[model samples]
Target: MESNLKWLRSCDLLIQNAYVFESALCRFVQKDVAVKDGLIVDVDKALALDSQKTLDGSGKYLIPGLVDIHMHIESSMTWPGAFYKQALRWGTTTLVADPHEIANVAGLEGIHEMISNALSLDIFFGIPSSVPSTREDLETTGGILDEGEVSELLKDPHMRCLGEVMNFNDLKQEDSKTRRLIQLCKQMRPDFLIEGHCPKLTGQDLSIYLAAGVDADHTHQTPASILEKAAKGMFLEIQDKSVTLENVQTLVTHALYDHFCFVTDDCMADKLYAKGHLNEVVKKAMAYGMPQTQAIYCATYTPARRMHLDDRGMIAPGKKADLVLLRDIASWQIEAVFKDGKPIASYPIPEASFSLSLYHSIHLDPLTEEIFQLHGYQGKAVQANVMVIEPHSTFTHRVIESIPIINGQIAYEKVGLNLVMVFERYGKNGQHAFGFVRNALQSSAALATSWAHDHHNLMVMGNDAKKMCKIANQVIACQGGYGIVDDHGQAMVHLPVGGIISDGPLAVTASELEEVTRRMRQAGYVHDHPIMSFATLSLPVSPELKITDAGLIDCRRQQIIPCIERVLTDEDND
Candidate 1:
């Protein structure tokens, strides 16, 4: 006790008698931690430390603050400040975000705006590797981030790694732009990580993609893909959707914890509020049979190591005092959170500022019912290609259906189909395309949003043309947001920043999203996440079929296909 006086006198804060999760050993041991100047000075058993502040962590579990290596702040729909505040409450002290959603709308300016708004040291960014997400002819975006933009962003200190390389198809070709971006990242920052987004890629294709220098992937994974990717020296970032029993058991049984970490790729406002952030993922992983120590390690140490953030992620000497005190390790209940040795409860809510131009991003002429009409051959019926939404998945299947023509317009309702349309809102071109969707909105209502994935274009769907036109115009009127016109009446949640982010607080956004979700479900939108499912309809790179301003896309073929395959005559109808 006498010898400990010198160290105790210099300690700024001391947490005594807690089960400290030693990440290096992947186990917990009772220890007292000493902190000074926001860095851990000592961690040992029964240290008689006296300090300015000391907390009796007698029954708590002391774990490293959670780290989310891959996520999207814009997907929360609020500004960066709001997201930071909410995340910290859930004990997530570190985050690596991919701002590609905003980049697609505002380009480099949008990326700069987000970086400026991030006033905290804990939040880092990845250079958006695929701002357009696909070829120009496949879809229209408000902005593009090509080689020049990639080169410029790599210079920023906050830019940790290249964001998820979403253009997997392009990476196969040597001269493709995606491959060039990978080469550029390697040349500029060879040690930096390169994230990936190759869903369902397997065998030789997956091997070829990894050969292109992508270090990690955070897409949905099957059991086989998980093992294969891990075996091939690729890092796995398991998000909420991939936290299944089979996936978690595979990791535990095979002892594959070292090669993988957890991430939250695109959590919506409501989900983040009600369910939690990376902490929730940790909980689910535990529930799915992952040991507590392994789960915590993956959420903290592994993610930090993956991002090359060596300063934090563990309770060790000289490490940043980013820690979480939990009342129960089994339930993962966080009692207190600290950042840099300071209690996060005392930290003020962060504020963010945006440019005036971000609020006025929508640049389309007024939409009308006439534009929603699909003009076809003046015949009795027409054979049209329809996009069928698969249940519980983003992949859509193409099917041909014969629809009756009324007044030179395809009567989609006659065959139980909904009209889906995409319009270029960038003011670059007044391009528009029409298609038919199965298992979308079943009521005589319309829903429109400028939050279309990777494009930020105006996408509308409904059974009634006039209602579709009304909602589409309403979304444009608000600059960018979700607009719904159903039996309950019009509802919206404005996202004025880059037409992909909300300018309001997280609570307001979450509440509005809840209301909008309730209305959408009432209007017969069948999806677990109505907003995300509807928004991603225009993401051309997602799967078998999708729609964009260019037209209906056969994603596998990577080309635009016509809406009307052929006009059916009387003989064909018979």
Candidate 2:
């Protein structure tokens, strides 16, 4: 095998007969080019540099490789290789991924898997910071990562900066551990790029957040929100997760596009293979009235600069030579992709390994039949507790005390009942939190996942504690999976992707999710889509109310409260 560095001394191939976007608005054309090894040593009109191969790109458009500032590899349901294969098909050459979901489920081992996967691939790694997310008492997690644990993880070359700091509430309220984390990262990398996760912050609070040296955000839910933060100098990561073409339109017309870049925070696998990655985002921007050049720059230079990735994201000499050729500016379809100046056949698989331990389960022991047994039904119906899902956001609606009970038990409106259970998956006992849910659940035997965001603990909610117990136990039974049991007491569906993702394709998972949705609707769930989002809304770290293994958490107050009222229900309120 020839060394790429040795090949750099002589040109291997070049193409110069194509239009190229040199800068935001400049367009230049050349007749011949030179690629030595895997680097573009020289590009010129005259064929001056010696080359081994040459190609005519008469009608193509050349541009720098597209970079994704923030994304999760697991969301695609495919491993990192599939992510790169699909991403490269659309001209995405690099990415920055947060393995928080995996970290919540697997802890240090999870971090190791992410590090390995990232090393195997040609992407960047933003080290995960908030491993368990909220405080331990607020919820259950598969694992936790403190400063000491994370500092060791950051030593890898692929580990660039701290992952998204999702616990802004903890940092803002002056939690010592949270404060220590910030200080530690700062001390280690004085100029490190710390990602922010302040969703819907405003005024003085936003000011304080910025003052804390937070750098970027992908949580802008509105155009005004983007403008507000951009004016304050925060790099806004324009996203396609919740934002559609309509939202992109509002952004390009209303806000300054320069401060914003493109990101697909949670695009499913089908979307990547079908539509594209950052390249699709650029087309979406142009369709919304953004100039072609500006859209490309936002996808390339803007995010690259924000991430401080100097060697990539541009078409300059003495760089890594990652480049993309486009069919045109309007469509933005990728013609070819190059990594290190060589046309890559496919995306490389990331350095990753399958690992499972006590950290993978919210509870080590499965929920036993005794724990989920029901005594009898009572006629004294009253209000219970509930967790609400926020639309188009990572945050959840707070855990509220406004739920209805039926026959002396909590019921979800006339749909069925709301039941919640927590399993101790960390190989410990006597500290597990369990309780009831009302209103939010939409089915009779339907159970939802407790990844409950940030924390990877198992918080299964259903109308039947036995069924919830079965679902919770199934997680242990299968190592990791979201489960739903029919009223007939059968395991209806299971998704076992690292306990958080499903190895099944997205469509199959979506179908299984649909089955869960159908059961919920049949039993009386009244939500627009399936209550899958309800699983995330149950997170205690975000806003509103949420339930953890510890108990019901008031996100606004950052504290846990009793699942049941201390006094008589109806009489007490009266």
Clashing pairs in 1: none
Error of 1 at 428 (Å): 0.4
- Candidate with top TM-score is 1
Number of backbone-clashing residue pairs for each candidate, in the order shown: 0, 21
What is candidate 2's local distance difference test score?
0.65
Clashes of 1: 0
Q: Write the per-residue lDDT of candidate 1 for residues 155-204, one digit (tens) a residue.
A: 99899999998887788888999989888888988887888988888889
Compute the lDDT of residue 537 as modeled in candidate 2: 50
RMSD of each: 2.0, 4.4
What is the lDDT of every predicted structure here? Answer: 0.87, 0.65
Find the 10 residues in a row with the least total lDDT in model 1.
Answer: 1-10
Off-target runs (Cα >4 Å) in candidate 1 are 1-8
